[model samples]
Structures are given as structure tokens and as C-alpha cells.
Target: MLLSGQSHAATESRLFLDGKELSLPEKVEIENLDGNVMIPIRVVVENLGFKVTWNQKSQSVKIEQRDKVVQLVVNDLMATVDGKQESLNAAPLLRKGSVVVPIRFVSEQMGMEVDWNNVDKVVSLITPVIEPTIKEPVKVPPTTGSGTSSPTTAPVVEPSVMLSQVNTIQFSENQLKISLSASVQPKISRLTGPDRIVLDLPNTMFSDSFRASQGLDNKLNGRLEVSGYPDVSGVRYSLFSSSPSTVRVVIDLNSAKKYTLLTETTDSTLITVQLREEDSVNIDPIVPNVPAVNDGRKKVVIDAGHGGSDPGATSISKKMEKDFTLAVALKVEQLLLQEPAIELIMTRNSDVYPTLQDRVDLANNMNADVFVSIHADSFSPTANGSQTFYYQRTNSKAFANVIHKYLIKATGFKDRGVTENGFFVIKKTKMPAVLLEVGFLSNSDNEALLFTEELQNKVAQGIVNGIKEYLGIK
Candidate 1:
């Protein structure tokens, strides 16, 4: 019923510019997925001085502003900004025959600022006059009850409240409180393998200002270990979804404990997770699951291409990219296991999809020396080759060059050569990262080779050798 209530609120979502409400076209309503707001292309694009065109043949949408051309394919998470490719967590969708795109990506790409007020289900837009400034919190009264009814044909949910901040309150050693910006009920769940509690805050957005303040080097973004703490280890939070607008807050604990949610407040809401010493018994402090290597072993995180819902590319023989990538990643893991001087981390070992943000977070949190992402290529059958890609970073090129040389030598697939592109996993990672397109799934020759265990082992060896060379290992 709460979820349904939020849905009703979303259907009546509105937009404002400098305090003035703007009229939106029909069926072209604004929707929120995860924490990002999506707006109809024609409404947002035409207003920003860009011409919008739909290519029916390609089933894609194009927006041209100034000299920039943006292309997005329906149901696909990959988009081309300028001329380079970028990954999107949420793909463009068609609702009631209208095209909608994630507003945050398009607006920022088109050079505009975006803000959201969840309580009123309103979004704000502005053009920066000088350096952008963070708006002081506008404490709006929370709306109650389901919103006005909509047509039966439309079932889309719109944006809700923004989750502005997450801060800790330490009453004493045994007591801890996690506070959220606005008053809203959130769902809580517990997990054992990692020994943590997850709080799913629906209809929420992780505030931009909080992220900027925390940046990359701070207590919020990095591991926060309070000295002499017995029950709690660290706390982490991330934007989990936009469709329902949920923000997940993860509290890493020393052991399981009873918790309580307190929403009986007029202002901010708090969730008190009891972390008393009696709750934990000889629990180990959270450490990297990676096996310990020599003192100076190079740490490498091998990210298998696509998995779960996103099968990267399919072969004529119906071989999924997910299977090939996992097979090769496992082989690479096997080869690396033979070396005592190198520690390896696999982004995934099973059939599952990890968001681009999650992959980068794992590498950065581990302080890995280098990051390698493996994938099979897609394109026309004639476009058969192996290509290594690195973003525009100094160390990225060197990593690509080393890995590509060995890969090309081993595969003997046409050398598509090393390329410079803004692929998501490579671009966001702090350490040296490269995405290796092992072979073309579109080509019969390459597909057959990729299916064989012998070739997969060779590809794995190539990656292992390149990592060794990059780390200066004999």
C-alpha cells in the first residue's frame, strides 16, 4: 500500500524553473528510476536548444546540441555522448508510446543543473550563472495519502522525496544512530555472509551536495573505523534504484543485533541499530576477502564482461557473452592462482550483474594497483578483431598497451588495436584500468575460437602475462 501510494504521488510529478512551474506535454511525463529523474526527450531537449530526432530504423533517439551529438538506443544501457561510449545504469524506456530518458544524464550532458524536492514531487532546473552553488535545504511539509487518480492505461511511477544526508550519531560506545534527511518509513533487512544490515529507503535520492562534500577522500566514502568499537565496523550507502527511487544504507557490523526504526518525528527520521557488545561474540573486523599475498604483490581486479540480465552479445550459435566472459574470467583466475606474488579479485564469479558503480567501488576500496575488465566484442561479422580500450588517463594507456600486446599476440585475431574511449568501468576506476575485447562474437571464426577451452586458456594466459609485465614481475 505504501508503494502504491508512492506510485500515485509520482503520476502527478511536476517541474519548476527558477520557482516558475513549467507545463509538460501529455504521456511525456517525468519518471524517477533509482534516484535519477527521467524526462521526455522532446520536452527537455527542445527546451535546451537541441533538436530531437527519432530513428525508427535503429530504434534509437538522437539529440544534437551545439557540436555534441547524443545517441541512445531503447532498452540498451549504452549511450554515445559526443563520439565516445558511456554506460548508463538505467536505460531509456517507452511508456505509452512516448520516449523518456534519464534527465540527470541528458541535462548535465547538455550543460544544465538539476535538483529534486521529494516531498512535493517537484524537480528544479537552472543554468549556472557562475560557479554552481548548493541550495540550502528547503524544509517542505510532507504530503499524505494517494494522489489524484490517473488514466487506467498509464502505470508509471513518478519521483518522490529526496534523501538528502546520512550522518551518524554516537550517543555512547554501545549506542549508535543513523539519521536521514526527511521523515519517511524505510524497509530494513539483514544479511549474514557479509554480516551487515541494509536499509532500503524508498522514494529517495542520495543528495548531490552530500556526495560532493564527501568526495573520494573522506569518512563517508571510505571505511570509517572507530577505535575501540565492538559491535559496528563501518557504514556504507549508495543509490540503489530510480524506478522506485530507493537509497540503500549498508551498516557493516561485527555481529548480528536487534534494531529499531523511529519515524515518529516532525523533522528528520532516524533508524537506531542497536550495536551493543552483547550482540557480538569474537567477530572479526571486516577485511578484504582477497587472499594474502607477498608484502608487495600487485592487486588486480578482473571484471568479467556481462552477466545476469545483460547478456553482452550473442553468437550465431546462441552462445551468450555472459557464459564466455565467465569461462574466461575463471580461467584467468586459475592461472593467477598459480602465482604466489599476485593477488587477484574477480568482480563476479557467478551469473550475476554488478552495476558499473559497484565494480569501481570494489577496486577503489581495495586500493588495487591495477584493474582489468574482460569482455567479448560485438558488431558486424566482418568486424572481427581484438581491441583493448583505456580511458583518457596517463596510466590507462600504459596498461592497455601492455595487455593488448600480449592479447593480440595470443589470439591472432585482427588487431583492432588499443583505443581511447570513455567506457564506464575503465573511466571511473582510480587505478590503471583497461577493457579488453577478446574477440568478436559477431564473427563465426572468432565465435568458434572463443567457445573452445584451448583458446579461452590462451586468452587467459595473455591477460595473466600482461598483468605480470605491467607489475614488473619476472
Candidate 2:
């Protein structure tokens, strides 16, 4: 059994089981509420050779070891220890997907002694040792032809290696070098939405010297900021898991780029990540051209947020935010096309990804009058509303306020109001720009409403109305 202090206090406090220090998993922290030291129930109970189970229907937790069993309900001050009712100073609660309980109560009930050092703010759990019974080994009879039996031997195992250091260099290519005590193959993968390349090193741990060099204490993660590199932004490393001991290194990228792993030999201890701009390929390009009609029509650029490899936010029904944004943008385009006083330009017309820079360049080159980027918000499931965002510019705020009025009316959801934010599309564009968070994808009601064609048409009309009102057109 082991006990840890509260989340705020746990940063400086140390946790010890017997005499050895333990490292808590990332995002799992002990919390103290009132006077009780709360700990994640699964972390402490499961490590003490106990089986922990949860009942989803009843919202309760059960822990069993041999004939002893303990049960706890969420937000209930009473618990059951072997069919006998027991009172608790504080009830168990859930935080960040883990159930936390009073550490002292759980530790004592599980037949362990808990000690808290006030001076050092250290938590220690002492378990009683059970002696194993010894039995005499049976001797085998000697072989008929052999005088002595062959001596038995145990196989020797090699110690696991550790990652020693990480460094970056920028020359013709952005290079990331990882040093290790021994050679190991790294598993590589890619992620989008602020693109990144991930490298996973198996059976490795961070060395003490490397931890000290990176200013990492018991926390198993650190980041290094890289400057003067175009494609590469920063490098992050962490102890991803403990049972199999996997270390993960993520290379943050400003955009999608091509990379290669360089090593001298199969057993080389140095792994180099060579990053370079992806080879340019010709595709359908957006032509920055003004309308030839010479009529004094205001040019508006409609941007759909994320597409292609980037799905943006996933809705409650698992629908992609890109799909919703594109759908709404197309409807807005249809509405604006019928108007004689408006000229429309779309950042993306299909299921394609236009980088933030690409969108900004197109708007700037064409000299648009107003820019509106369509996107659906995402957060907790309970977060559902309509809002608009603008950068710090005065004209942008006026643009956002006008658009938000009609947007809230169209969505008919909660009015979250207009706010100021430095969104890339809105901030970089020279014209009056506003990014509309039409509704939340995480909310079931909003997701269903957004998929309806009637609502899409209404929202498109509202956006056009807002634009016309801002431009002083009837």
C-alpha cells in the first residue's frame, strides 16, 4: 500500500513504498480535500496485490484481496468492509477519469500502516512481510553410467539501456539526435492538427544525467524549444509507459514535412531524425483573381477550418468538424452567389486541407474586404453554445459582434457571446476578420442540429445577413 499527498502538495512531496520511491503516472496526482489525503484508488489498491473492479450501473468500486473485500460508492460517506458498515471522513470522487479515496482509510483497511512526515511532506506505506515456508529439496538418484550429476546453472540476463541525451541541429536539414546507452529500433508514426512526428523507443528509461540536464525531476517528461528552424518547432520526450518501459519522443512540426531516420549501423547508439520540407507537388491551385465585372461588390473569403488528414474536432456521433464546416461554407457560398452586391471566395471547396499560411496568403493577395472562417467548437460534452471570435483589431471586434448576433439566432443554442482571440486565420488576414464557432461538436444536441439541412440553410442566411448589415447594404 502507498499513499500520496494532494495534487498541489504532491509536487513537492515524495511517495515511498517500504524504502523505495515510486513515480506516479502522468496526469495521475494525489489530492487532499479538507484534512484527508486523497489518492487514486486504482493506483494504490492494484499495486498492493488486490483486484479492483468497478460497477458502471451502480457507480461503485470494489477491491478484493483473499477473503477481504471492500466496497465504496461515489459521493457516499459510508463504505463496507467485509459486510460491516464503516464511516469515512470524506467520500470517494472521480477526477480526470480516476476514482480517488481517502488514503489513510484505504491503507489501514487493507492491512497496511500509513505514515505522513509533516516536515518533509513525505507519504509512506509499510506492509507486513509474510515469511515463506522452507522445504528440503529432494535428491535425485545418480545416473547408472555417470559418477556425478551435471551442475545446474541459471541463464544470465542483460540490463536494460537508457536514453542519455537529446540535441537538435539546423543546417541544410533539421536534424534531431538521440543518444542511448545501447542500440534500439524506434517505432515511428505521424499525427496531424499541428502536425507532429512521433518516435517510440522500447525497453528504455531516461538516465539520471539526462534527467538532470533537462531539469526533469520525478516527472518523466520534458520539452526542448528549437528556434531558427522553419519546419521543426520543438521536441518533446516522455516516459510513455512503465511496465514495458517505453520512451516517446515527439517532434512538433509547423507543417507537414518529410523525414528520415539516419543510423550508421544496425547496432548504432545514435539515432538521427532528419527533417526536410516535403517535395512540392503540383495540384489544383487557388487562383487569386478578382471578379471581372468591375461592379463595386465587397469581396468575402469563406474559410472551412480543417480538412484532409486533419479532421478537426470529433463530434458526439463521431462526425468530423471538417465535414460540418465545409457543409456550412458551401451553403453560405450558395446564398452569397445569388446576391449581386457580393463576391465570394472559398478557401477550400472540397475535402482538402489548406494550411493556415495558404489561407492567409490567398486573402492578402486577392485583397478581400472581409474574412469569415467557419468552425465548430469542441470541449466537454456539456459545453454547447454559439460564439464568435475576433483578434485585437478594432474593426474585427465590430465584425464579430455583428456576426454573432445573427449566428446565435440561427443556431438557437445558448448565447456564449463574442470574445477576442488570436486565431491564425482571423489574425493574419488584413481585412475585418471573424471566426465563428457555430456550435459545439461535443454536445449531442448541437451535433444533431448542425447536421440538419434546415439549420445549415438558416445559419448560412444569418451569416450573409450579418455581412450585408456590416457593409451598410440593405
Candidate 3:
């Protein structure tokens, strides 16, 4: 099961040790009355945006809100909800003094929903409505190609994305004006075998026939340049587009140097190559241009934007964008985690809101192939549904297309249309990055559905599938 929770409540079954309904602790692990499975309640409740608590002295579990309290007794089959006699199908049992209940009945009664697969013996809980949840974003180190499947279920979650169709690249003019972020930097490496230079571009351009052009010999002379550059032997190039704002171009070089890069209007990527005299450069002119070899997978960075402090784009539902985004992000994470090759990373895993700059910084630092910032948009609840935004740049065109199609198919938000905006995260990111407005928080009708895990996962899965198509990975 890609998304599994502890034993969730099914029929409003609350545990009452006596006539007093007990409160459950926040983020505590509770076992079933049968004592078969221990469920981690933190992940579940966090997604649900509920307060959980445990009393060490009393050895009891309590979940309290502003007015209501749900209490459970250790090893006791009885529970109390707001101090009332409530019948329990399964009583709260004690484990080493702490009370635990079945995840099925409890999660449900506590204003959450659960899905059960009898055939597979799996239980998943969806928080009814996500409120304010704080989270932080951290960067993970690097890895190679050879992508594995995404763990949208129980097994895998990767930090990569794929590119599929190139929908459209709209330019205000025939030649679009695009700029790179100062924080956006590239890696320069030398390959051993072929005398070639490699360029790692953050994104692949949008064109029916678009690929990096590499040459070993100085083709400027048009002498059918073999590997004959005296200063540099050859060059290899590749571009992977995860978002409109991202692409990675790896230029294989004959020798290594401290290079400064600049892209000019003539479409020539100038690499002021300064190599050490320590190595002799070899060039090969006869070799044909090579295609970039992907690990055959893409990295997915599911950003639960606006955690801890900054809650971006709030709605009238009193539902913080931070919480809604986290809930959806979790769903996306769970769904992608099942895939073996698809590595998953959350820009914000908890309620803490991460800064826009830090969010982009993580993606860049991690060297993520693709970055998707999940956000629940808000306006007048009357103005509901979802729409995605990308930077107004030509480089991000391909990345935007792949994600655009998939989001429409998955979320089914009002096709607000893909437009250009100068969002801080996407523009500043060094990699292919896109900001997704899952749905309008201002829209009341859409918010109801937005709170569900099923819908959230479906949307998440759609994004994953879209990435897969872009990368040409099954």
C-alpha cells in the first residue's frame, strides 16, 4: 500500500474506559486492541491537522481541541469522548502503560476518513481538512542516472522528474527574453575516454528537433572538425527539462578548468575555458553528436510550500495554505514512494513554512532534476479550482508543457490556464522548477474535495506520471 495509516476508525467507534470519552495524544503510536500492529499516529494526525497528546504520569492518551477532549485508558477497552459514555467496539489497550487504539475506528471518529482494502489488508487514512502545518525543507546530496520506479505506494520515493510532451512555448516575441538566476550554478567535469567537453544545462529547450550540439574539433573553421581542438579536445552536452525553469546540461570536456559560463543572444553558450597545463587536451572530430543518457528516471521534489511561519495564499475556509499543501504533499510523497526508481523529497515535510529562497536553494543544492512546489491556491471560495504557474522564460517551456498536461488530467481543477508569472521560487531556482496551485482555497466547493487523501494522491500520482512521460521512463 502506497498510503497506509494506523488502524483507522470505521463507524464512529470511540473508546470509553468508563463513561468518559478519552483523548488521544498527538503523534503517538497506538496499537490495536488485538495488539497486532503498532501505528504511528504522528504522520496521520499531522496530515489531519489535529492536536494529540499523552500523559506520562497518568499513562493515558488524550487528544484535545479548544472545546473537546478524546481520552483513552491503557489496556482498557473503554474510551470517553468529551466526558460521555461511549461504546467501543475495540477498547483502548495499554502498552507499557500508554493507551493505544485501533487506527480504523479512531481516525474516522476523530473527523478523518480511512480507506480499507480487504483483499490486501491495507488501511489508509485521509485527514478530513488540513489546517496550518509547519515544515522545513532540507537538501539531499547527489546521485547518478539509472532511475528506479516511483514509490507511490509503500516502497519507493525518488527525488527526480521526467519530461514527456512539449505542449507549447509561447513567446511575447519570436525570440524570448530569458534570464538565469545568480544562484544557479553548473558543474564542470572531464571525461576520461573521449576527448570531449560536457555542458550540463538546467533544462532542455522546446523544439521538434532540439538536442545539444557538441564538437571535438573547432567547427567554427568548418574543417569537418574531428577531435582537433588544440586547447580542448571535444564537448558532450545534455538537457533534461523537469520544469520550465529547470534543465541540466552536462558538458564533457577534454580537460578540466575553473570555467565561467555565459549564454549570449546568438544562442552560443560561451565557456571561457581555462584549463591547467598539467594535462594535454585531445580532440576527436569524427565522432557523431551523442544523446544524453538519463538514469532513465526523474527526480521529484514535492514542495509543501509555506510551512512553519509563512502561509502563502490563504483562503476564507480558515484552512491555511500551509496545512493544505502539506496534506497534499504527503499524499504525493506516499504515492511516489511506492515506485522503486522515483526518489521523493519534500521541500517542507512538517508544518514549518520554508522561505521561498530556501525552497529553491534546496532544489539547486540537491541537484534535483525536477522540482514541483505544491500549493493550495486561495481566493474567494467562490473562485475555486487549480492552476499551475511557471516563469515567463523560454528555457522553462518544455518543463512547463509536460507538467501542464498531467495536472489537467489529474486534479481536474478549473483549467485556469498556464500563464507566466515571476514567482520567486521558480525563477530563482537553478534547476527546472514549477509552482503548482492545486486548487483555489477561496473556492468553497473545491476545498471540500481538496481535504481528501484520495484526491490528493490522485493529483500527486498524476504529477508523477507526467514526470515519467517527460523523462520517457515507464
In model 1, the number of clashes is: 8
Candidate 1 stretches with Cα past 4 Å from truth are 1-294
Which portions of model 2 show Cα errors greater than 4 Å? 1-294
Residue pairs in candidate 1 whose N, alpha carbon or C atoms collide under 3 angstroms: 10-158, 33-242, 33-243, 34-241, 34-242, 34-243, 35-242, 118-161
Tens digits of per-residue lDDT for model 3 on 311-359?
5555656777778888877877877788766767788788885666677
lDDT of 2: 0.70
Query: Per-residue alpha-carbon lDDT of model 2 for 150-248, expressed as tens digits?
Result: 111112222343333332221211456676776556656554444677676656678776677665545477787764344668887777644345577
Best by lDDT: 2
- The Cα RMSD in angstroms, rounded to one decimal, for candidate 1 relative to the true structure is 23.0
Which wins on TM-score, candidate 1 or candidate 3? 1
RMSD of each: 23.0, 24.5, 27.6
The alpha-carbon lDDT assigned to residue 151 of candidate 2 equals: 12
lDDT ranking from best to worst?
2, 1, 3
TM-score of each: 0.41, 0.43, 0.38
